[model samples]
Target: MFATKYRVAGITALAIAASVSLAGCTINMPGSTSDSNGMMDGGMMGNNQNSSGFSGSDIMFAQMMIPHHQQAVDMSTLAETHTTNPELLALAKQIKDAQAPEIEQMTGWINNANASMDMGHDMGMGGMLSDSDMAALAAANGPAFDKLYLEGMIGHHEGALDMAQMVIDSNNAEAKTLGENIVKSQTAEIAQMKKMLAGM
Candidate 1:
């Protein structure tokens, strides 16, 4: 029985390895079709071996990023509730508008992947914020608040970039698309934030 199991595992690996040579590689794995149009093929699927849903790396990336994105949105929300500066308020609204949809998208991916919703269950990085961090942001005001907010947001964006790179490094094709997008978006945002911080 053990020998038979090993043989099955070896065969599975062989099949997967062989599929690497197929055209439109990233989104197209064997045992899958791209619908009526050939153009719709693997480009969208990202070379997945499993048809049921997301790869493990993809799931991990989604779970971790959801909370990380949420934190950025959450911090931004604080500015609306707690600040008076028009400039700072505008920044807060921008962060909230941008990240809120991203949080939803990540959440949808986690659900679609058949992954657990309880981020507490070792779901990577989407855990709740610490009480102290919340208080520090809450108490800040004026340029001091703007400086802290920008600094804090930069760290938050860095965390997202780290998790995104984790997905890219894993080479989960479908997830890599999302990961690459995150890298592009956050890197730009981080640079922008730094410029704002320097002026402050």
Candidate 2:
């Protein structure tokens, strides 16, 4: 009877330990809470990518940056038709080339998290240009266009760097990798643009 009781006790202990371990794992993963009515905020859905180890910050970074990079690509497209300066043209091409792939990559990250990409109109952070500013840029041509493109893009790149840095603590390996790449590449591009603007 003593031996049977010992075995039962051991089994109970193992079951309790397993439950505790699973609880710890659940606590460590990112999670969202719903309202008392059980309705979850749309942003919360975008912020939680626990399946991929992504935190809220990682999701925010990717979402904000998608529109921001799209703006850069749009501005770069303007430069193609509006500017005569070879340097400005080359820089515009480079911006589009680098950011297009990044935009796609960030989109994948957001989708992987099952997050909504439609983050609404006010998603602008860092140094995002106003719509009026973009309109003015579109209206410009020749040296004026070059000047505006260089200045505007420098600000845009700064914003990207800011977004990337904000997600530096993400546990998601892919998000972290993209963030690091943005910091390194955009920093160099920003410096190069500064030099070009000064020379012009």
Candidate 3:
């Protein structure tokens, strides 16, 4: 009878040990670390995952900003063929380089959230060039192109600054970070563009 009791006790202990081992594995799963709120830590997911903490505003900002950034990139591309000014060309390249990656990052956020890419209707995205404006830009070359491009982009960047400010106060960490970055970089660029405009 005593032998049977010991055997039963041993089995219970082994079962508990196995259960704990499995639990440990789950807690230590790769690429997941929970904070006190049970939300995943930012470093673990790197803004790629759409955490529950994300708000509607976060998604809206990303969706709207993607197209906004795309326009800036398109405008920059026009400079390559339209302007021979070294300063203007360099600035165009800088805008393209900065905004293109941001477009991809925002796209990833939208995809992760299973959100629609479409703005669904005209949200009156600030500083977007009209089709006629783009056509005018495409047709122009030399100093005319440089002046138009700089002025158009200044307005575009200002619009982006407004949009970025909307989300800077949001609770979403990723969105807030992007917003701050936009405000900082674009603010400096705006100053530089103003100085460049003054020269011309």
Candidate 4:
């Protein structure tokens, strides 16, 4: 009878140990409820291939940049009607072409991650034109418009470069790649715009 009692006790101990191990594993699992909720609270998602590798900063980078890029695209569109300068027109088109695709890509990343598109605040994004500034740009024409466009875009590109630097060292591969591209392309465009401004 004592032997049988000891055997039953051994079995009970083993069952308790197994339960404890499973509880620990569940807590650490990638898609665990607690862990996932925490990530989501920080503007990140969990369990999906696209979101699994993203950090909070990666998600924030994508979220904030989408609107910033959209504003650039809008500014470029304004150039079509406001400027007849061939160089200004061409540069405007280049900015639109480059940034429009990037906006779409960043949107896709946010959607895939199940993050909100809205950043819920201005984020103090540098170089964004105020309503009055945009109104002035829209009202100008010819050489006046060209001057404003070059100056505005140079500052805008510089702002983007600053934002990109935040994500350049991201652990997420996609975010890092995009950040590097922004730095490279915008740096070149900034130099080009400065030269155009000087010539004008």
For each candidate, give its TM-score against the true structure: 0.65, 0.74, 0.73, 0.76
Give each model's whole-structure lDDT: 0.58, 0.66, 0.69, 0.66
Candidate 2 per-residue lDDT over residues 1-200, each given as its tens digit: 11111112222332332233222112122355556743243333223446655655566666667887898899999998998888888888988998899899888866665666754433325556777888999999998887777787777776666566655655677877887888898899889988998897
Candidate 1 residues 39-103, lDDT tens each? Answer: 32323332342443565445545655676677778788888867687766877787778778877
Q: What is the Cα root-mean-square deviation between model 4 and the actual structure?
A: 19.6
Scored by lDDT, model 4 comes in at 0.66
Which pairs clash in the backbone of model 3? Answer: none
Q: Would you give me the overall lDDT of model 3?
A: 0.69
TM-score winner, 2 or 4: 4
Ranking by TM-score: 4, 2, 3, 1
Which structure among the candidates has the greatest TM-score?
A: 4
Compose the digit string of candidate 3's lDDT tens values, residues 60-100: 66766898899899999999999999998999999999999
Instruction: Name the regions of candidate 2 deviating beyond 4 angstroms.
Output: 1-49, 121-124
* Cα lDDT over the full model 1: 0.58
